[model samples]
Target: MLDLHHIFAMQKKALFFLLALCALGWGFTSYPTVFAGIAIGACFGTYNFWILVRRMDKFDRSISEGRKVASLGSALRFGSGIAAVAIAITLPEYFHLISAVIGLMVPYVFLFIGVFVSSVRNKGN
Candidate 1:
């Protein structure tokens, strides 16, 4: 099994990179709205990432205990993501929806990449 610490480290790197990218763009554009959007998006992205990590941890625990795991986490994740996007889209005047959306995907992208790397490393053993 892959270490959760390594996974989190990768995710953290992605978060910082994404935040820096947003900050740079905001700085270059001198747009308060862009900064606000990035802030909101980063919050939601981090929230989603933690939720996923928690769910996976719970699943692992359940498996080790020989119990069936529930699927409520998936629904909650989807609902939260949808809500974030909806709010971003509705508040067009305050946030750049595209930037916010991109920010929101940062954690997932990094997590996926981390998983891929881990899988490849294990396969080589």
Candidate 2:
């Protein structure tokens, strides 16, 4: 069984990799569209991260109360990369460059935020 820390680390690494891929893709693609994709992806990624954190907090509370906690489904749902990719594919041609950059950066930003939040919470305890 995976511990919380292990799970967190795994998630963080996945996010980082996703971000790097997005950045690399952006660099290889044209401008504008890539930037737009990145911007949109970042917004979505941040939103997903926050939602996952809240859900995890709730799950922890449930566990403390002896209730059966949900599996990692929520996390998977929140990290739905398919949605991000779909959005990226739909970006306007003129904004493709920006979108690509954002796509790459968003994942890394998500991981950073998650790690920062986790560290802060651990320190508080």
Each prediction's Cα lDDT score?
0.75, 0.60
Clashes within 3 Å, all models in order? 0, 25
Q: Give model 1's TM-score versus the native structure.
A: 0.72
lDDT of 1 by residue, 2-119 (tens): 6766677677777777777766876787685676577567768877877878888888889899999866387777777777778778997877777677767767777788888888
lDDT of 2 by residue, 37-110 (tens): 66556656655655566677778989999998876456565455556666556645634544544554555554
Q: 29, model 2: CA deviation in Å?
A: 14
Instruction: Give the TM-score of each candidate.
Output: 0.72, 0.51
- Candidate 2 has a TM-score of 0.51
